[model samples]
Target: MSEIQKALVVHAEEAERIGLPHGGGFRLLADGRDTGGALGANRLSLGEGAAGARPHFHALSTELFHVLDGVVRFTLDGVTSIVAAGGLVSVPPGTPHSFGAAPGSAAELLVVLTPGVDRFGYFRALGRIQHGLGTFDDLLPASEQDRYDVHFV
Candidate 1:
């Protein structure tokens, strides 16, 4: 099938290969193939008291985020910045960064990972660990977090 056909035929049911983790308090909205090319777009909606992804670096990729609603507090290279509605932020490759919505408010944001990194696999692994629905410890070892270049403070 053509790429467009592939995309259009994708239903929410077939997209069940992954889901957000328990602690994440967010629902993920894209699969690895959604990007179609170098650009991959995903979204995370934060609930009250919810934080975003773990601090991570993409040695071979870059990312951009556009805050659609609510307040988001994000960190870049240890520096904290708040992104409110209609705000945009960009992070270059190899930069350590993470984001979270302010307490008691809902936040909506679009996250685009360029050159798409291994995000699909990372999130799938996270869901496995968080939900206990499956086992995938062999895929993502805690000791080799740096191998993925993801770190937490």
Candidate 2:
């Protein structure tokens, strides 16, 4: 007899929230291990003018973002675009990208990474850096960044 895999569910109120220094935050829904390495998911809330992420790329994962509220500005390669609520953007592996809440606009987003890389720790470290508990240099090592699949350009 085959064993049945249980479903994974995270209620909004129960999600782990990681607060950023600039009024932005991340609500962690699922990590790669929880999904058997299939995907990782999270919700990001950014206050007006909040920086989301600096230029980076995943060498092995594709990232998807769904704008749930307000507007977001995304830079792919060297082109920048404004994505309003309800917009979706898919970034393939190796594509350099960055994002932030559009100037003067707060934003909410659902973010997913496929072929999941365990990235919750990466997010946590980022939060710590933002809060002055850690330094960006901590994540600057190639081995450290590779562990989370984020390669800064």
Candidate 3:
């Protein structure tokens, strides 16, 4: 018999949420291991004026963001743009980018990393730092970030 494939389903109430320092949060949907390395996914909810992500790039995967609510501001390679709900952005590997809620607005986004990297640990680490249980420096080492494919510039 051949290997069996199973579907993965994450109900809204069942997703794990990770809180960020600025009142935002991440609802993890699936990690690489859960999807057999096809993709990792999460829903990011940003408070008004909250920073979603600082400038960074992935060396091994393309990151895609689909705006699920409100407006978001994105800085891609130093250029800034405003994306409203329903907008989608795909950043290729090695391209520097960052994002946040538009000033005075709250935003929600569905984020996906293709050719997936197991990023749940990174998200959990961020939550730890946000909660004062860990330091940002803990994630600065190459061994730490490399495992998630996220590189800070």
Candidate 4:
């Protein structure tokens, strides 16, 4: 860990864990504020056939993914590729992209966004919706896209 990491690392128990079915949930490891806007990161564990991110673009941030287990299917721009454990992929700002666990496979991936945007609220809403505690309506208005940092394409 770098000096910055030593100061900012989010310990496992300290991390915010979001629940989901079949072990597909998110663990927020770090957010923009924690890293002083250097980056945002989280661990995503997905089950077979679990839906992942929809096509979206970060107008001002780059997104990265590192598969740690199983296979993940990433659709970058107009192409799709299956990345297995140990694979890494990075998408620059403005690139339309999406990702999910490959059909019939389970996966875990580390996701990071550079010059990070605070997306904890957005992700929390996702957990709520998935578990029936809330509706998609809870996310926010499209007009507030800049606030949440996700612009579905």
Candidate 5:
């Protein structure tokens, strides 16, 4: 029998293991190497004061953020914009961008990274840090971040 390889069969414990905590921050439904898919997709939920991600630039992929609830503050190429519920923001490739939840409010959104999907591993590793499963300094050296195809924006 051919071995079946896939990700996404996640339970609460499994979700917690792969960088998701119960009702915390984000949940990754599919990543680059998981399920043999090319696109990196994730469902992110940021509570008050939570930043969506480190401001960074992708050398070769465009990103899109579709808000599901609440308000989100998105910064693209140094300009910040507020997106309300059901709004979507698209950041063109090579733009320096990031997002965060509004202070004292919550936000849920979908994030998609195209072209370079393996980049998802960085976030997964970061999740390990968030879960107290590992220690990463406040800043991850460019050497490490570059391995996951990220660069300072």
Candidate 6:
């Protein structure tokens, strides 16, 4: 069967927002369906010391980050740097990378994943764990490899 395509629109108030465990909020802008698996986007707001994803890589997708406010500390291939507001960075598929809000400052950014992965469940599970509704181990089942394709490096 062929898939149908349609434009997706999301206003500020329409974003699906999720609070992170440590200190951050994520607003999902577009999912794989909306972009026809081409890309997905989320707006992230993190306080100082907020924990971001661990060092990992997407085997089949590129991750891009655009700093909208404050600074973010990004560790890419063992090198770390503070990306100030308005700065942009892109991690090619298979690159080892991690990121978080700067130690003494907060940050806001727009994160995009190209060749999108179906990660809404991952995002929701993260919020549930942060809110004490689920355990960290519950975030990733043995079948997660098939579901999200996340590779920890």
How many angstroms is residue 53 displaced in model 5 relative to the true structure, after the best TM-score fit?
A: 1.7
lDDT by residue (1-153, candidate 3, tens digit) is: 854657999999999999887778999999998888889999999999888888999999999999999999999999999999999999999999999999999999999999987999999998898889998899899998798899998
**Lowest-scoring 10 consecutive residues by lDDT in candidate 3?**
1-10
Q: lDDT by residue for model 1 over 1-153, one digit each (tens)?
A: 745524434344554444444333324455345656455555666776576776776665678899888889889999999889999999998889988887776788877767654455556666666678666544446554544434444
Q: lDDT per model, in order?
A: 0.66, 0.94, 0.93, 0.87, 0.71, 0.85
What candidate 2 gets wrong by more than 4 Å, as runs, is 1-5
Candidates 5 and 6 compared by lDDT, better number: 6
TM-scores of the candidates in the order shown: 0.69, 0.95, 0.94, 0.91, 0.75, 0.91
Per-residue accuracy of model 5 over 49-142 as CA lDDT, tens digit each: 5776778887767788899998998888989999989999988777888888877778888787775466556776777777887766633687
Q: What is the C-alpha RMSD of each candidate to the true structure, in Å?
A: 4.7, 1.7, 1.6, 3.2, 4.5, 1.7
lDDT of 4 by residue, 38-126 (tens): 89999999998677888888898999999999999999998999999999999998999998899999999999999887888888889
Best lDDT goes to which candidate?
Answer: 2
Q: Model 5: which ten-residue window has the lowest total lDDT?
A: 13-22
How far in Å is the alpha carbon of 28 misplaced in model 4? 0.6
Writing each residue's lDDT as its tens digit, candidate 6 over 1-153 gives: 868778888999999999875568889898877889989889988888787788888888899999999989999989998899999999998889999998888899999999887787778887887798987777456477457756766
- Alpha carbon RMSD to native, model 3: 1.6
Q: Give the runs in model 6 whose Cα sits over 4 Å from its true position.
A: 1-4, 21-23
Model 4 misplaced regions, further than 4 Å: 1-6
The superposed Cα distance between candidate 1 and the true structure at residue 24, in angstroms, equals 6.6
* Deviating ranges (above 4 Å) for candidate 5: 1-23, 35-37, 131-139
RMSD of 6: 1.7
